[model samples]
Target: MSTSSIKFYDRFSKLYPIVDVFLRPQKRRLFEEINLLDHGKLLEIGVGNGTHLGLYKKHALIGIDTSKSMLSKAIDYATQEMQLLHMSGEQLEFEDHCFDYIVLSHVIAVVEHPEKMLEECCRVLKKDGSLILLNHFTPNNFLGYIDRAFQLFSPIFHFKSAFYLKDLKALKKIELKEQIHFSRLRYFKLLIYKKP
Candidate 1:
Protein backbone atom coordinates (compact mmCIF):
# COMPACT_ATOMS: atom_id res chain seq x y z
CA MET A 1 0.00 0.00 0.00
CA SER A 2 1.09 3.55 -0.70
CA THR A 3 1.74 6.09 2.06
CA SER A 4 -0.84 8.44 0.58
CA SER A 5 -3.52 5.73 0.65
CA ILE A 6 -2.70 4.79 4.22
CA LYS A 7 -2.77 8.49 5.18
CA PHE A 8 -6.16 8.88 3.53
CA TYR A 9 -7.61 5.97 5.58
CA ASP A 10 -5.94 7.33 8.73
CA ARG A 11 -7.85 10.58 8.26
CA PHE A 12 -11.07 8.78 7.34
CA SER A 13 -10.99 6.43 10.32
CA LYS A 14 -12.91 8.84 12.57
CA LEU A 15 -15.63 9.51 10.00
CA TYR A 16 -15.87 5.93 8.76
CA PRO A 17 -18.72 5.10 11.12
CA ILE A 18 -20.98 7.67 9.59
CA VAL A 19 -19.93 6.54 6.12
CA ASP A 20 -20.55 2.89 7.04
CA VAL A 21 -24.12 3.60 8.10
CA PHE A 22 -25.29 3.76 4.51
CA LEU A 23 -24.03 0.23 3.83
CA ARG A 24 -25.27 -1.28 7.09
CA PRO A 25 -28.58 -2.41 5.65
CA GLN A 26 -26.87 -3.98 2.66
CA LYS A 27 -24.31 -5.71 4.86
CA ARG A 28 -26.99 -6.99 7.21
CA ARG A 29 -28.94 -8.49 4.36
CA LEU A 30 -25.87 -10.19 2.95
CA PHE A 31 -24.70 -11.65 6.26
CA GLU A 32 -28.14 -12.96 7.10
CA GLU A 33 -28.08 -15.67 4.44
CA ILE A 34 -24.57 -16.87 5.19
CA ASN A 35 -24.06 -19.45 7.96
CA LEU A 36 -20.97 -18.73 10.01
CA LEU A 37 -21.85 -20.80 13.06
CA ASP A 38 -20.22 -23.96 11.69
CA HIS A 39 -17.24 -22.17 10.20
CA GLY A 40 -13.79 -22.00 11.76
CA LYS A 41 -11.48 -19.00 11.91
CA LEU A 42 -12.74 -16.03 9.90
CA LEU A 43 -10.42 -13.44 8.40
CA GLU A 44 -11.82 -10.10 7.41
CA ILE A 45 -9.57 -8.09 5.16
CA GLY A 46 -9.77 -4.30 5.39
CA VAL A 47 -11.84 -4.59 8.53
CA GLY A 48 -12.12 -0.83 9.00
CA ASN A 49 -13.11 0.36 12.44
CA GLY A 50 -14.40 -3.18 12.98
CA THR A 51 -17.97 -1.94 12.70
CA HIS A 52 -19.24 -5.30 11.45
CA LEU A 53 -17.18 -7.44 13.78
CA GLY A 54 -20.16 -8.34 15.94
CA LEU A 55 -21.80 -10.18 13.09
CA TYR A 56 -19.21 -12.94 13.22
CA LYS A 57 -19.84 -13.90 16.83
CA LYS A 58 -19.53 -17.62 16.28
CA HIS A 59 -16.09 -17.63 14.72
CA ALA A 60 -12.72 -16.27 15.76
CA LEU A 61 -12.25 -13.02 13.89
CA ILE A 62 -8.82 -12.06 12.64
CA GLY A 63 -9.29 -8.60 11.20
CA ILE A 64 -6.44 -7.00 9.30
CA ASP A 65 -5.98 -3.47 7.97
CA THR A 66 -3.12 -1.37 6.66
CA SER A 67 -3.84 1.79 8.64
CA LYS A 68 -2.71 2.02 12.26
CA SER A 69 -5.30 4.70 12.87
CA MET A 70 -8.08 2.39 11.73
CA LEU A 71 -6.76 -0.57 13.72
CA SER A 72 -6.52 1.56 16.84
CA LYS A 73 -10.18 2.47 16.53
CA ALA A 74 -11.09 -1.15 15.83
CA ILE A 75 -9.37 -2.23 19.04
CA ASP A 76 -12.30 -0.88 21.02
CA TYR A 77 -14.58 -3.40 19.34
CA ALA A 78 -12.23 -6.35 19.82
CA THR A 79 -13.50 -9.41 21.66
CA GLN A 80 -11.61 -12.28 23.30
CA GLU A 81 -11.73 -14.23 20.03
CA MET A 82 -10.95 -11.26 17.85
CA GLN A 83 -7.43 -10.06 16.98
CA LEU A 84 -6.98 -6.86 15.05
CA LEU A 85 -3.74 -6.62 13.09
CA HIS A 86 -2.20 -3.71 11.24
CA MET A 87 -1.31 -5.62 8.11
CA SER A 88 -1.85 -5.59 4.36
CA GLY A 89 -4.00 -8.21 2.64
CA GLU A 90 -1.70 -8.41 -0.40
CA GLN A 91 0.93 -10.17 1.69
CA LEU A 92 -0.86 -12.16 4.38
CA GLU A 93 1.40 -13.91 6.89
CA PHE A 94 -0.32 -17.24 7.23
CA GLU A 95 0.08 -20.87 6.19
CA ASP A 96 -1.88 -22.26 3.27
CA HIS A 97 -5.54 -23.12 3.98
CA CYS A 98 -5.46 -21.69 7.48
CA PHE A 99 -8.91 -20.14 7.39
CA ASP A 100 -12.32 -21.66 6.70
CA TYR A 101 -13.79 -18.37 5.57
CA ILE A 102 -12.63 -14.90 4.48
CA VAL A 103 -14.43 -11.60 4.22
CA LEU A 104 -13.21 -8.97 1.80
CA SER A 105 -15.89 -6.41 2.36
CA HIS A 106 -15.49 -3.27 0.29
CA VAL A 107 -11.76 -3.98 -0.13
CA ILE A 108 -11.14 -5.09 -3.71
CA ALA A 109 -11.28 -1.71 -5.40
CA VAL A 110 -9.26 0.18 -2.80
CA VAL A 111 -6.02 -1.83 -2.81
CA GLU A 112 -3.41 -0.86 -5.41
CA HIS A 113 -3.30 -4.45 -6.75
CA PRO A 114 -6.58 -6.13 -5.93
CA GLU A 115 -5.69 -9.26 -7.89
CA LYS A 116 -2.59 -9.87 -5.80
CA MET A 117 -4.54 -9.50 -2.56
CA LEU A 118 -7.17 -11.88 -3.92
CA GLU A 119 -4.52 -14.46 -4.72
CA GLU A 120 -3.33 -14.23 -1.14
CA CYS A 121 -6.90 -14.63 0.06
CA CYS A 122 -7.26 -17.81 -1.97
CA ARG A 123 -3.88 -19.06 -0.84
CA VAL A 124 -4.79 -18.92 2.83
CA LEU A 125 -8.37 -20.11 2.45
CA LYS A 126 -9.13 -23.79 3.00
CA LYS A 127 -10.75 -25.74 0.21
CA ASP A 128 -14.53 -25.31 0.07
CA GLY A 129 -14.14 -22.13 2.10
CA SER A 130 -16.22 -19.17 1.08
CA LEU A 131 -14.78 -15.78 0.19
CA ILE A 132 -17.42 -13.13 0.67
CA LEU A 133 -17.02 -9.85 -1.18
CA LEU A 134 -19.15 -6.76 -0.83
CA ASN A 135 -18.40 -3.74 -2.98
CA HIS A 136 -19.67 -1.32 -5.60
CA PHE A 137 -18.99 -3.10 -8.87
CA THR A 138 -19.58 -1.18 -12.06
CA PRO A 139 -23.09 -1.70 -13.44
CA ASN A 140 -23.49 -2.28 -17.16
CA ASN A 141 -25.56 0.80 -17.82
CA PHE A 142 -25.68 4.59 -17.50
CA LEU A 143 -24.72 4.35 -13.87
CA GLY A 144 -21.55 2.49 -14.89
CA TYR A 145 -20.59 5.24 -17.29
CA ILE A 146 -21.00 7.81 -14.54
CA ASP A 147 -19.03 5.56 -12.20
CA ARG A 148 -16.16 5.38 -14.70
CA ALA A 149 -16.13 9.17 -15.05
CA PHE A 150 -15.70 9.45 -11.27
CA GLN A 151 -12.52 7.35 -11.35
CA LEU A 152 -10.57 10.60 -11.69
CA PHE A 153 -11.14 11.29 -7.98
CA SER A 154 -10.21 7.75 -6.72
CA PRO A 155 -6.69 8.94 -5.87
CA ILE A 156 -8.23 11.38 -3.44
CA PHE A 157 -10.86 8.97 -2.04
CA HIS A 158 -8.60 5.87 -1.95
CA PHE A 159 -11.27 3.74 -3.66
CA LYS A 160 -12.00 2.73 -7.19
CA SER A 161 -15.24 4.18 -8.52
CA ALA A 162 -15.16 2.06 -11.67
CA PHE A 163 -13.99 -1.34 -10.47
CA TYR A 164 -15.00 -4.44 -12.43
CA LEU A 165 -14.89 -8.12 -11.43
CA LYS A 166 -13.40 -9.20 -14.74
CA ASP A 167 -10.25 -7.22 -14.04
CA LEU A 168 -9.46 -9.51 -11.10
CA LYS A 169 -7.45 -12.51 -12.34
CA ALA A 170 -7.75 -14.59 -9.17
CA LEU A 171 -11.49 -14.87 -9.73
CA LYS A 172 -10.88 -17.56 -12.31
CA LYS A 173 -9.37 -19.82 -9.67
CA ILE A 174 -12.62 -19.91 -7.66
CA GLU A 175 -16.24 -20.61 -8.41
CA LEU A 176 -18.82 -17.94 -7.78
CA LYS A 177 -21.54 -19.46 -5.60
CA GLU A 178 -23.93 -16.60 -5.01
CA GLN A 179 -24.58 -12.99 -5.98
CA ILE A 180 -26.83 -10.57 -4.14
CA HIS A 181 -27.75 -7.19 -5.62
CA PHE A 182 -29.22 -5.51 -2.57
CA SER A 183 -28.92 -1.87 -3.54
CA ARG A 184 -32.04 -0.42 -5.09
CA LEU A 185 -30.07 0.90 -8.06
CA ARG A 186 -27.88 -2.20 -8.18
CA TYR A 187 -24.91 -0.03 -7.30
CA PHE A 188 -23.47 -2.52 -4.79
CA LYS A 189 -22.93 -6.25 -5.39
CA LEU A 190 -22.36 -8.96 -2.78
CA LEU A 191 -20.56 -11.97 -4.17
CA ILE A 192 -19.79 -15.29 -2.48
CA TYR A 193 -17.06 -17.48 -3.97
CA LYS A 194 -16.18 -21.03 -3.05
CA LYS A 195 -12.64 -22.35 -3.50
CA PRO A 196 -12.79 -25.76 -5.09
Candidate 2:
Protein backbone atom coordinates (compact mmCIF):
# COMPACT_ATOMS: atom_id res chain seq x y z
CA MET A 1 0.00 0.00 0.00
CA SER A 2 1.10 3.57 -0.57
CA THR A 3 1.95 5.87 2.36
CA SER A 4 -1.06 8.02 1.52
CA SER A 5 -3.37 4.97 1.56
CA ILE A 6 -2.06 3.97 4.98
CA LYS A 7 -2.56 7.49 6.25
CA PHE A 8 -6.06 7.58 4.83
CA TYR A 9 -7.05 4.41 6.66
CA ASP A 10 -5.45 5.59 9.89
CA ARG A 11 -7.50 8.76 9.78
CA PHE A 12 -10.68 7.01 8.70
CA SER A 13 -10.38 4.30 11.35
CA LYS A 14 -11.71 6.72 13.95
CA LEU A 15 -14.97 7.13 12.07
CA TYR A 16 -15.09 3.60 10.63
CA PRO A 17 -17.96 2.53 12.86
CA ILE A 18 -20.12 5.34 11.60
CA VAL A 19 -19.01 4.61 8.07
CA ASP A 20 -19.78 0.96 8.61
CA VAL A 21 -23.33 1.73 9.59
CA PHE A 22 -23.98 2.61 5.96
CA LEU A 23 -22.45 -0.67 4.85
CA ARG A 24 -24.47 -2.83 7.20
CA PRO A 25 -26.73 -4.09 4.42
CA GLN A 26 -23.83 -5.15 2.25
CA LYS A 27 -22.09 -6.64 5.27
CA ARG A 28 -25.20 -8.59 6.10
CA ARG A 29 -25.31 -9.93 2.55
CA LEU A 30 -21.67 -10.98 2.87
CA PHE A 31 -22.42 -12.90 6.06
CA GLU A 32 -25.38 -14.60 4.44
CA GLU A 33 -23.25 -15.69 1.48
CA ILE A 34 -21.38 -18.22 3.57
CA ASN A 35 -22.23 -21.01 5.95
CA LEU A 36 -19.96 -20.29 8.90
CA LEU A 37 -20.58 -23.35 11.07
CA ASP A 38 -19.18 -25.70 8.44
CA HIS A 39 -15.70 -24.21 8.66
CA GLY A 40 -12.94 -23.99 11.25
CA LYS A 41 -9.75 -21.99 11.79
CA LEU A 42 -11.26 -19.03 10.00
CA LEU A 43 -9.01 -16.13 9.01
CA GLU A 44 -10.68 -12.84 8.12
CA ILE A 45 -8.57 -10.37 6.17
CA GLY A 46 -9.22 -6.64 6.50
CA VAL A 47 -11.46 -7.13 9.49
CA GLY A 48 -12.27 -3.45 9.83
CA ASN A 49 -13.66 -2.47 13.24
CA GLY A 50 -14.70 -6.10 13.68
CA THR A 51 -18.13 -5.38 12.30
CA HIS A 52 -18.40 -9.04 11.35
CA LEU A 53 -17.23 -10.28 14.75
CA GLY A 54 -20.66 -11.38 15.86
CA LEU A 55 -20.97 -13.80 12.98
CA TYR A 56 -17.66 -15.47 13.80
CA LYS A 57 -17.90 -15.35 17.58
CA LYS A 58 -18.83 -19.00 17.90
CA HIS A 59 -16.09 -20.10 15.54
CA ALA A 60 -12.33 -20.03 16.06
CA LEU A 61 -11.24 -16.93 14.17
CA ILE A 62 -8.21 -14.72 13.72
CA GLY A 63 -8.95 -11.26 12.28
CA ILE A 64 -6.18 -9.11 10.81
CA ASP A 65 -5.97 -5.47 9.83
CA THR A 66 -3.35 -2.76 9.18
CA SER A 67 -5.13 0.07 10.99
CA LYS A 68 -4.35 0.39 14.70
CA SER A 69 -7.60 2.16 15.50
CA MET A 70 -9.58 -0.50 13.67
CA LEU A 71 -7.73 -3.21 15.58
CA SER A 72 -8.44 -1.42 18.83
CA LYS A 73 -12.13 -1.62 18.08
CA ALA A 74 -11.71 -5.29 17.15
CA ILE A 75 -10.09 -5.98 20.52
CA ASP A 76 -12.98 -4.37 22.29
CA TYR A 77 -15.54 -6.22 20.17
CA ALA A 78 -13.82 -9.61 20.17
CA THR A 79 -14.68 -12.43 22.52
CA GLN A 80 -12.18 -14.49 24.57
CA GLU A 81 -12.27 -17.10 21.80
CA MET A 82 -11.37 -14.68 19.04
CA GLN A 83 -7.91 -13.34 18.19
CA LEU A 84 -7.06 -10.02 16.54
CA LEU A 85 -3.76 -9.17 14.86
CA HIS A 86 -2.21 -6.00 13.54
CA MET A 87 -0.93 -7.04 10.14
CA SER A 88 -1.34 -6.65 6.41
CA GLY A 89 -3.27 -9.13 4.31
CA GLU A 90 -0.68 -8.84 1.56
CA GLN A 91 1.90 -10.43 3.85
CA LEU A 92 0.09 -12.90 6.05
CA GLU A 93 2.10 -14.29 9.00
CA PHE A 94 0.79 -17.82 9.10
CA GLU A 95 1.93 -21.32 8.24
CA ASP A 96 1.05 -22.89 4.89
CA HIS A 97 -2.17 -24.88 4.77
CA CYS A 98 -3.13 -23.89 8.32
CA PHE A 99 -6.57 -22.46 7.83
CA ASP A 100 -9.73 -24.22 6.74
CA TYR A 101 -11.36 -21.06 5.47
CA ILE A 102 -10.15 -17.62 4.35
CA VAL A 103 -12.63 -14.77 4.34
CA LEU A 104 -12.22 -11.38 2.69
CA SER A 105 -14.69 -8.52 2.68
CA HIS A 106 -13.92 -5.86 0.10
CA VAL A 107 -10.19 -6.43 0.58
CA ILE A 108 -8.66 -8.21 -2.40
CA ALA A 109 -8.96 -5.18 -4.66
CA VAL A 110 -7.63 -2.33 -2.51
CA VAL A 111 -4.31 -3.92 -1.48
CA GLU A 112 -1.13 -2.83 -3.25
CA HIS A 113 -0.26 -6.19 -4.81
CA PRO A 114 -3.54 -8.00 -5.10
CA GLU A 115 -1.99 -10.91 -6.99
CA LYS A 116 0.60 -11.45 -4.27
CA MET A 117 -2.04 -11.26 -1.58
CA LEU A 118 -4.16 -13.85 -3.38
CA GLU A 119 -1.10 -16.09 -3.64
CA GLU A 120 -0.60 -15.80 0.11
CA CYS A 121 -4.27 -16.52 0.67
CA CYS A 122 -3.96 -19.66 -1.46
CA ARG A 123 -0.80 -20.76 0.33
CA VAL A 124 -2.26 -20.59 3.85
CA LEU A 125 -5.50 -22.27 2.87
CA LYS A 126 -5.68 -26.03 3.42
CA LYS A 127 -6.25 -28.37 0.48
CA ASP A 128 -9.92 -28.76 1.34
CA GLY A 129 -10.41 -25.23 2.49
CA SER A 130 -12.63 -22.64 0.89
CA LEU A 131 -12.01 -19.01 -0.04
CA ILE A 132 -14.81 -16.51 0.20
CA LEU A 133 -14.35 -13.10 -1.42
CA LEU A 134 -16.97 -10.38 -1.34
CA ASN A 135 -16.35 -7.26 -3.39
CA HIS A 136 -17.29 -5.28 -6.48
CA PHE A 137 -16.29 -6.84 -9.81
CA THR A 138 -16.59 -5.23 -13.19
CA PRO A 139 -19.36 -6.72 -15.33
CA ASN A 140 -17.20 -7.35 -18.41
CA ASN A 141 -19.43 -5.13 -20.52
CA PHE A 142 -20.31 -1.44 -20.67
CA LEU A 143 -20.52 -1.05 -16.89
CA GLY A 144 -17.14 -2.70 -16.73
CA TYR A 145 -15.78 0.01 -19.00
CA ILE A 146 -16.98 2.57 -16.52
CA ASP A 147 -15.36 0.65 -13.65
CA ARG A 148 -12.12 0.49 -15.61
CA ALA A 149 -12.36 4.20 -16.29
CA PHE A 150 -12.67 4.80 -12.55
CA GLN A 151 -9.18 3.39 -12.01
CA LEU A 152 -7.86 6.71 -13.24
CA PHE A 153 -9.33 8.30 -10.16
CA SER A 154 -8.36 5.57 -7.67
CA PRO A 155 -6.10 7.89 -5.68
CA ILE A 156 -9.04 10.18 -5.13
CA PHE A 157 -11.74 7.66 -4.21
CA HIS A 158 -9.41 5.33 -2.28
CA PHE A 159 -12.26 2.87 -1.92
CA LYS A 160 -12.93 1.01 -5.17
CA SER A 161 -10.43 -1.12 -7.08
CA ALA A 162 -10.68 -2.20 -10.70
CA PHE A 163 -10.33 -5.87 -9.80
CA TYR A 164 -11.81 -8.59 -11.97
CA LEU A 165 -11.72 -12.36 -11.55
CA LYS A 166 -9.88 -12.63 -14.86
CA ASP A 167 -7.09 -10.51 -13.38
CA LEU A 168 -6.37 -13.06 -10.64
CA LYS A 169 -3.08 -14.75 -11.59
CA ALA A 170 -2.37 -17.22 -8.78
CA LEU A 171 -5.62 -19.15 -8.68
CA LYS A 172 -5.09 -22.25 -10.83
CA LYS A 173 -5.34 -24.57 -7.84
CA ILE A 174 -8.89 -23.66 -6.87
CA GLU A 175 -12.20 -24.39 -8.56
CA LEU A 176 -14.95 -21.82 -8.74
CA LYS A 177 -17.75 -23.08 -6.54
CA GLU A 178 -20.18 -20.27 -7.19
CA GLN A 179 -20.56 -16.64 -8.23
CA ILE A 180 -23.50 -14.66 -6.85
CA HIS A 181 -24.48 -11.09 -7.51
CA PHE A 182 -25.30 -9.03 -4.42
CA SER A 183 -26.52 -5.82 -5.95
CA ARG A 184 -29.45 -4.89 -8.16
CA LEU A 185 -27.09 -3.21 -10.59
CA ARG A 186 -24.84 -6.32 -10.58
CA TYR A 187 -21.81 -4.37 -9.38
CA PHE A 188 -21.08 -6.30 -6.17
CA LYS A 189 -20.30 -10.03 -6.37
CA LEU A 190 -19.69 -12.92 -4.03
CA LEU A 191 -17.19 -15.49 -5.22
CA ILE A 192 -16.67 -18.88 -3.63
CA TYR A 193 -13.71 -21.03 -4.54
CA LYS A 194 -12.64 -24.33 -3.03
CA LYS A 195 -9.30 -26.10 -3.16
CA PRO A 196 -9.57 -29.63 -4.45
Candidate 3:
Protein backbone atom coordinates (compact mmCIF):
# COMPACT_ATOMS: atom_id res chain seq x y z
CA MET A 1 0.00 0.00 0.00
CA SER A 2 1.06 3.60 -0.58
CA THR A 3 1.77 5.92 2.33
CA SER A 4 -1.37 7.84 1.56
CA SER A 5 -3.52 4.70 1.68
CA ILE A 6 -1.87 3.62 4.91
CA LYS A 7 -2.53 7.03 6.41
CA PHE A 8 -6.11 6.99 5.23
CA TYR A 9 -6.86 3.66 6.93
CA ASP A 10 -4.93 4.71 10.01
CA ARG A 11 -7.18 7.72 10.35
CA PHE A 12 -10.23 5.62 9.65
CA SER A 13 -9.31 2.85 12.08
CA LYS A 14 -11.17 4.66 14.80
CA LEU A 15 -14.38 4.49 12.75
CA TYR A 16 -13.89 1.00 11.29
CA PRO A 17 -15.50 -0.86 14.17
CA ILE A 18 -18.59 1.26 13.71
CA VAL A 19 -18.52 0.77 9.96
CA ASP A 20 -18.15 -2.97 10.44
CA VAL A 21 -21.31 -3.10 12.52
CA PHE A 22 -23.41 -1.93 9.58
CA LEU A 23 -21.61 -4.35 7.30
CA ARG A 24 -22.59 -7.44 9.27
CA PRO A 25 -25.31 -8.69 6.96
CA GLN A 26 -23.07 -8.92 3.95
CA LYS A 27 -20.14 -10.13 6.00
CA ARG A 28 -22.27 -12.87 7.49
CA ARG A 29 -23.22 -14.16 4.10
CA LEU A 30 -19.57 -14.17 3.04
CA PHE A 31 -18.62 -15.98 6.21
CA GLU A 32 -21.28 -18.60 5.60
CA GLU A 33 -19.67 -19.46 2.30
CA ILE A 34 -16.22 -19.63 3.82
CA ASN A 35 -17.47 -21.96 6.52
CA LEU A 36 -17.89 -24.65 3.89
CA LEU A 37 -14.15 -25.10 3.62
CA ASP A 38 -12.56 -28.06 5.42
CA HIS A 39 -10.03 -27.42 8.14
CA GLY A 40 -6.55 -26.42 6.99
CA LYS A 41 -4.23 -23.46 6.81
CA LEU A 42 -5.82 -20.39 5.24
CA LEU A 43 -4.38 -17.11 4.01
CA GLU A 44 -6.49 -14.00 3.97
CA ILE A 45 -5.31 -11.07 1.90
CA GLY A 46 -6.26 -7.60 3.04
CA VAL A 47 -7.34 -8.81 6.43
CA GLY A 48 -8.59 -5.49 7.77
CA ASN A 49 -9.03 -5.30 11.54
CA GLY A 50 -9.26 -9.08 11.63
CA THR A 51 -13.02 -8.71 11.96
CA HIS A 52 -13.55 -11.88 9.95
CA LEU A 53 -10.92 -13.88 11.79
CA GLY A 54 -13.34 -15.19 14.36
CA LEU A 55 -15.44 -16.80 11.64
CA TYR A 56 -12.83 -19.46 10.92
CA LYS A 57 -13.30 -21.83 13.85
CA LYS A 58 -11.66 -24.90 12.40
CA HIS A 59 -8.88 -23.49 10.29
CA ALA A 60 -5.48 -22.20 11.29
CA LEU A 61 -5.34 -18.69 9.86
CA ILE A 62 -2.65 -16.36 8.56
CA GLY A 63 -3.51 -12.85 7.51
CA ILE A 64 -1.62 -10.23 5.51
CA ASP A 65 -2.28 -6.58 4.90
CA THR A 66 -0.32 -3.61 3.68
CA SER A 67 -1.34 -1.23 6.45
CA LYS A 68 0.54 -1.31 9.72
CA SER A 69 -2.35 0.34 11.51
CA MET A 70 -4.73 -2.32 10.29
CA LEU A 71 -2.31 -5.05 11.30
CA SER A 72 -2.04 -3.48 14.72
CA LYS A 73 -5.79 -3.71 15.11
CA ALA A 74 -5.73 -7.29 13.85
CA ILE A 75 -3.03 -8.30 16.32
CA ASP A 76 -5.34 -7.53 19.19
CA TYR A 77 -7.55 -10.41 18.02
CA ALA A 78 -4.75 -12.77 16.97
CA THR A 79 -4.40 -16.00 18.90
CA GLN A 80 -1.10 -17.81 19.34
CA GLU A 81 -2.19 -20.06 16.46
CA MET A 82 -2.70 -17.19 14.03
CA GLN A 83 -0.01 -15.15 12.30
CA LEU A 84 -0.40 -11.69 10.82
CA LEU A 85 1.99 -10.25 8.28
CA HIS A 86 2.34 -6.70 7.00
CA MET A 87 2.44 -7.17 3.26
CA SER A 88 0.86 -6.19 -0.03
CA GLY A 89 -1.50 -8.39 -2.03
CA GLU A 90 0.44 -7.92 -5.27
CA GLN A 91 3.57 -9.45 -3.80
CA LEU A 92 3.11 -12.38 -1.41
CA GLU A 93 6.04 -13.46 0.74
CA PHE A 94 5.32 -17.16 0.83
CA GLU A 95 6.45 -20.37 -0.79
CA ASP A 96 4.52 -22.13 -3.54
CA HIS A 97 1.57 -24.27 -2.44
CA CYS A 98 1.92 -23.05 1.08
CA PHE A 99 -1.77 -22.74 1.91
CA ASP A 100 -4.73 -25.03 1.49
CA TYR A 101 -7.12 -22.15 1.06
CA ILE A 102 -6.74 -18.50 -0.02
CA VAL A 103 -9.21 -15.73 0.52
CA LEU A 104 -9.62 -12.38 -1.22
CA SER A 105 -12.45 -10.43 0.33
CA HIS A 106 -12.98 -7.02 -1.20
CA VAL A 107 -9.26 -6.80 -1.84
CA ILE A 108 -9.03 -7.19 -5.61
CA ALA A 109 -10.87 -3.96 -6.43
CA VAL A 110 -8.52 -2.04 -4.16
CA VAL A 111 -5.21 -3.41 -5.41
CA GLU A 112 -2.98 -1.70 -7.97
CA HIS A 113 -2.61 -4.96 -9.92
CA PRO A 114 -5.46 -7.42 -9.48
CA GLU A 115 -4.04 -9.91 -11.97
CA LYS A 116 -0.70 -10.05 -10.23
CA MET A 117 -2.50 -10.51 -6.94
CA LEU A 118 -4.52 -13.41 -8.33
CA GLU A 119 -1.35 -14.92 -9.72
CA GLU A 120 0.17 -14.78 -6.28
CA CYS A 121 -2.93 -16.40 -4.85
CA CYS A 122 -2.65 -19.20 -7.35
CA ARG A 123 1.04 -19.63 -6.68
CA VAL A 124 0.56 -19.93 -2.94
CA LEU A 125 -2.33 -22.37 -3.15
CA LYS A 126 -1.85 -26.15 -3.20
CA LYS A 127 -3.01 -28.20 -6.17
CA ASP A 128 -6.80 -28.43 -6.15
CA GLY A 129 -6.87 -26.02 -3.23
CA SER A 130 -9.64 -23.46 -3.21
CA LEU A 131 -9.55 -19.70 -3.61
CA ILE A 132 -12.58 -17.93 -2.25
CA LEU A 133 -13.44 -14.36 -3.14
CA LEU A 134 -16.20 -12.16 -1.83
CA ASN A 135 -16.22 -8.88 -3.66
CA HIS A 136 -18.27 -6.15 -5.27
CA PHE A 137 -18.15 -6.16 -9.03
CA THR A 138 -20.14 -4.49 -11.80
CA PRO A 139 -23.74 -5.56 -12.06
CA ASN A 140 -24.88 -6.97 -15.38
CA ASN A 141 -27.71 -4.43 -15.45
CA PHE A 142 -28.06 -0.65 -15.51
CA LEU A 143 -26.72 -0.52 -12.00
CA GLY A 144 -23.34 -1.28 -13.52
CA TYR A 145 -23.45 1.96 -15.43
CA ILE A 146 -24.26 3.82 -12.24
CA ASP A 147 -21.30 2.16 -10.54
CA ARG A 148 -19.06 3.13 -13.44
CA ALA A 149 -20.14 6.78 -13.15
CA PHE A 150 -19.64 6.76 -9.41
CA GLN A 151 -16.16 5.24 -9.82
CA LEU A 152 -15.12 8.28 -11.82
CA PHE A 153 -15.75 10.40 -8.73
CA SER A 154 -14.03 7.95 -6.36
CA PRO A 155 -10.73 9.79 -6.68
CA ILE A 156 -12.35 12.96 -5.37
CA PHE A 157 -13.46 10.96 -2.34
CA HIS A 158 -9.88 9.74 -1.83
CA PHE A 159 -10.89 6.20 -2.85
CA LYS A 160 -8.07 5.80 -5.35
CA SER A 161 -8.01 2.01 -4.99
CA ALA A 162 -11.47 1.31 -6.35
CA PHE A 163 -11.63 -0.43 -9.73
CA TYR A 164 -14.30 -0.50 -12.42
CA LEU A 165 -16.37 -3.61 -13.31
CA LYS A 166 -14.31 -5.18 -16.08
CA ASP A 167 -11.45 -6.05 -13.84
CA LEU A 168 -13.17 -9.30 -12.84
CA LYS A 169 -12.45 -10.61 -16.31
CA ALA A 170 -8.80 -10.91 -15.37
CA LEU A 171 -9.67 -14.07 -13.47
CA LYS A 172 -9.94 -15.88 -16.79
CA LYS A 173 -6.19 -16.31 -16.98
CA ILE A 174 -6.20 -18.56 -13.93
CA GLU A 175 -7.18 -22.21 -14.14
CA LEU A 176 -10.35 -22.79 -12.18
CA LYS A 177 -12.20 -26.04 -11.58
CA GLU A 178 -15.43 -24.42 -10.51
CA GLN A 179 -16.98 -20.95 -10.34
CA ILE A 180 -19.90 -20.19 -8.10
CA HIS A 181 -22.05 -17.05 -7.84
CA PHE A 182 -24.15 -16.18 -4.81
CA SER A 183 -26.02 -13.18 -3.40
CA ARG A 184 -29.23 -11.61 -4.68
CA LEU A 185 -27.55 -8.36 -5.57
CA ARG A 186 -25.76 -8.68 -8.88
CA TYR A 187 -23.16 -6.21 -7.70
CA PHE A 188 -21.78 -8.69 -5.19
CA LYS A 189 -20.09 -11.88 -6.40
CA LEU A 190 -18.79 -14.93 -4.58
CA LEU A 191 -16.21 -16.83 -6.54
CA ILE A 192 -14.76 -20.28 -5.83
CA TYR A 193 -11.76 -21.27 -7.88
CA LYS A 194 -9.60 -24.37 -7.61
CA LYS A 195 -5.97 -24.65 -8.58
CA PRO A 196 -5.37 -27.32 -11.21
Q: Report the number of the highest-lDDT candidate.
A: 1
lDDT of 2 by residue, 41-67 (tens): 989998988866886634589999887
TM-score per candidate? 0.95, 0.90, 0.87
Clashing pairs in 1: none
Give the poorly placed runs of model 3, Cα more than 4 Å off.
Answer: 156-166, 175-183
Candidate 1, lDDT over the whole model: 0.87
Give the best candidate by TM-score: 1
Against the reference, the lDDT scores of all candidates come to 0.87, 0.80, 0.77
Off by over 4 Å in 1: none
lDDT of 3 by residue, 1-196 (tens): 5677667777777788987896677678777777877888899998989876877778889999887888999988888899999888788999999899998887777666678888888888898788888777776777667777787776543453335445555566555554445556566666777777
> Residue by residue across 79-112, what tens digits does model 1's lDDT show?
8778888889999999999998898888889999
**Least accurate 10 contiguous residues by lDDT in model 1:** 30-39
Q: What are the RMSD figures for all models against the true structure?
A: 1.3, 1.9, 2.4
User: After best superposition, candidate 1 residue 190: deviation in angstroms?
Assistant: 0.8
- Model 2: residues with Cα > 4 Å off, grouped in runs: 36-39
